[model samples]
Target: MLTKQDVHVLRTLLQEYAHAASLPVNQEKQRLWIKLNHLHMERPMVLIDQIPWNEMDVDGSLRCLVADTYWRQVEDNLRCTLYKFRHMPADMVLNPYVCLPRPIHNSGWGIEPVSSRHIELEMGSTAPSREFVNQIQSLDDVERIKIPQLTLDEKREAQIIQEADEIFSGIIDYRLTGLCMHLGIWDSIAMWMGVENCYFALMDEPEMIHALLEKMTEGLIDMIGQMNRQKLFDIHSHVCHCSQTFLEDMPKENDLPLSGNAWAFGLAQLFTSVSPAITDEFEVQYMKRVFPYFGAIYYGCCDRLDDRMHVIEKLPKIRKLSCSPWSEREHFAQVMPRYCVMSNKPNPAFLASGKLDEQLIRDDIRRTIDAAKAHNRNLELILKDISTVNHNPSCLWRWQEIAMEEVQR
Candidate 1:
């Protein structure tokens, strides 16, 4: 039950969101994103995500006024949306209607790792120097990672809509949509045991690695199949890993599950040192089982995949290829097919410094823009994995401005 204050807070934000959505710039961004996604690009696009919202403390932007924990989250979201629009809205679409996540509970894959040491940083965010606890040592131990089952609570889901409607009866409407499904098998393996152990096992116990991967692969496929069978693949994903995803290809009006309508994000970020053939054998082969089921796939993350394109390209339905800061941008721009959207993930480390280097950030964006321009590739700049902005919110605002200037140039 939302109090009058909660309803007032929500309705106020709803009016602002509705007004922002009515703007022509958002529609133009939608056009640019659709063109880039379809590989019919006139110019480059920019998107910033994985932002450090904790640090964006300007005039109570992040401070929630609501009382209830759940409603406070709703208030926080509305506040953040309006804040981003005012601050550094890159190429993201400000959708008019409100969206509520369906109450879907997942009986997760049962494996937990331990975090022992914490490192407080002077510049970056505090992180855990996790105790690389090995949960999988034997072949039978892999059986512990179960196939995740999802249960959608319809009553709760309806209650949320009813509550939202009673609050925003004439303002903005709401929809129950799911989020993007990212399938990273090796990432899961790294989480369960340890990233270092994952590499060591590949060399020392290759058979064990294969067995573990095989089970995990089967488990993920089972999860996807269950979602499809349950009609739970309906996602209204605006972006997948900071890359714009709204496109004509991913039909909005579809009958079959969104497995064949939306995108599936995949990556093996720690596969940086592994050879193409080895990655192909261990990672790609297994992940491809989960890939073919999706309408489209956006592959790679912070990994330098320029050299590994031979193996990387083997995965079917790959529309977006991540060209991270480590990736040889020129090589990827020249090598990747013109049809594939080159999602150039710019490094956010510059902002983590004591002071922002405008020229350095400018040069980075310039280099990527040049690479894409030279090869005539479909390009989109994505700044992600930002842990901290050195307590300065202007770091990101300036970054988006520079990125937008570069792309629009």
Candidate 2:
């Protein structure tokens, strides 16, 4: 449902990729096309507020040697705008998904390095120390001298074929760009398994947290079967970002095909800073066993959005369900009238204070288009970036002309 010259040729190719990211050899393809150009489109909701939050380390026990030189200057300004967006072809821009290498999950899994010099060598240790989980189970680039290529199993199978070639190159650019292909790379493997070992590990030890989340979901299905053996891999779009931590029934039926991926899923609920009855006992029982491995699914991400609106009112083939910025815009316009497509984020300190206060950003874009035009459906507002906010890019080209005049009146 995106007409109007396909949102004016995606707001003129995201304002000529944000004016070629303030030039300088297209600053790493304008910071990975301004944070993965809304996952190269197909209703991949983005509002824009610039958020890196010191490259998030929710519990990997910080100390990325002074934040890996500002995350390699935002991955050399996103591989200089993906080598000037011929969608990455300048000698495959060092393709390992452009920039890949990671580890530091309790020092690549043996657990217990909660840092600050392992809390001053476990100060008054009482237990929970087999030499502090065997010195955070395996970290050797000379005892974890800040996790550079310690070859965590061949750089996690080349970062799962560089995140399955960004969802098989966005389903081959959504069949030559019809649009709606926003892949987030399964929350970048849940930020390399450190959202508290991907959510509390069955409250810490349900058979050693289901044998380390089933050997990290069988090394994420052998890095998504080497990202479905690269070359053009099938294209079905509809994958969003963040959310996952299951536990309740703890996947038994032959661990639901190694926990998810048929294609199409989305969730946001950033573990609501824990405790909404432990985010409904481990984020709604491991996302109801990864919701039928998806056709489409979504839940909140930024603010609890009424604690995952009762698991987005039981998502089956969810089409889009965020309301966040701490939802309740008239109870998400009366509970997302007719199950799905709401989005509506708006609030990265009101688009990062570069104050052009066009009557307070056109009265918050006319109260989010009169609250999603009386909730018939489909709204879309998202200006994210919750931590270390910083981006403005003329408030993402003036909120794409105030979200195309509130999704066309």
TM-score for candidate 1: 0.95
Against the reference, the lDDT scores of all candidates come to: 0.81, 0.41
Error of model 2, residue 294, in angstroms = 2.9
Model 1 poorest 10 in a row by lDDT: 122-131
Backbone clashes under 3 angstroms, per model: 0, 23
**How far in Å is the alpha carbon of 68 misplaced in model 1?**
3.7
Error of 2 at 72 (Å): 8.1
lDDT of 1 by residue, 156-250 (tens): 87787788778778887776676468788777778777888888898898999998888878888888877777667645646677677888756
**Each model's TM-score, in the order given?**
0.95, 0.25
Q: Point out where model 2 deviates above 4 Å.
A: 1-239, 242-318, 321-337, 345-353, 358-364, 367-373, 376-380, 384-409
